[model samples]
Target: MTNTEITIHTDGSCLGNPGRGGWAATLRRYEGGKEVKKRSINGGVKHTTNNRMEMTAAIQGLKKIKKGEKAQITVYSDSRLLIQGMTDWHHKWQTNGWRKAGGKPVENRDLWEELLTVTDELNVQWEWVRGHAGDRRNEEVDAMAADAAYKAA
Candidate 1:
């Protein structure tokens, strides 16, 4: 609401590829390049994929923006699939009726659609960060997600 841009860092963790999973998002608002506000949210499920948790983190993070608050958002994640899908691949998939180039249904169509809906409500930019590369915020969310996954398990 203050016209200050908000940045969100998100991560997801799974015990196994298709095992208990968790996701986390940390949001920050900066003014004059100084962080003025911060909040974190996390959740987990007994059965899910890392990809699903990754998308969930982004969706839940974006949802934290208050309604009617029009602020530019930049989302950072280590998941290339999440970032690339949202920034590039989703358009083609949508145009092709949610099917991949090979005529196979997009694996996470539901989450993709939900992400699109949430993103449409705001101005968003996607950024990819390498996981475990020492980015402080990224590392924080990574730990948060891992802890959540363990708790869920």
Candidate 2:
């Protein structure tokens, strides 16, 4: 993996809350002009929630960064649930033994753990983008996710 700083746009889509779901991540950078790299990650599951799909998108996208790559990745997502879960709630969840208040189990604990582990292997910066705001990268990933969901359905 190149050491170049990578900007990633991620998104998740679902045909229904318990129906086909998809996730996507698009990596972008142009430090080397025509030689610059652009890569995308996208997939779907038959039964899932939008939140789960959102988490999956982050997981798959972050996993694309090789173990040894020192690339600093900025992940932009339209899902506030994902962005806030990672940036805000995850630390508390860890401290609480992955439980929420009142001892409720954290939802998507498996994916959250995976994301944390992968993020530890790289420099990651998370940001939130408004969905359907016409940001090119965000739109691209959104479309990719929708397409993946369509295929899965």
Candidate with maximal lDDT:
1
Number of clashing pairs per prediction, in order: 0, 0
Candidate 2 lDDT by residue in tens digits, 57-139: 88887777788666567989999988998899999999999999789999889989988998886878899999998898899
Clashing residue pairs, candidate 1? none
What lDDT score is found at residue 14 in candidate 1?
A: 98
lDDT of 1 by residue, 1-153 (tens): 335789999999999999999999999998766789999999999999999999999999999887656677899999999999998999999999999999999998999999988887688999999999999999999999999999995
List residue ranges in candidate 1 displaced over 4 A: 1-3
User: For model 1, what is the C-alpha lDDT against the true structure?
Assistant: 0.94
| TM-scores for all predictions | 0.95, 0.90
- Model 2 score (lDDT): 0.86
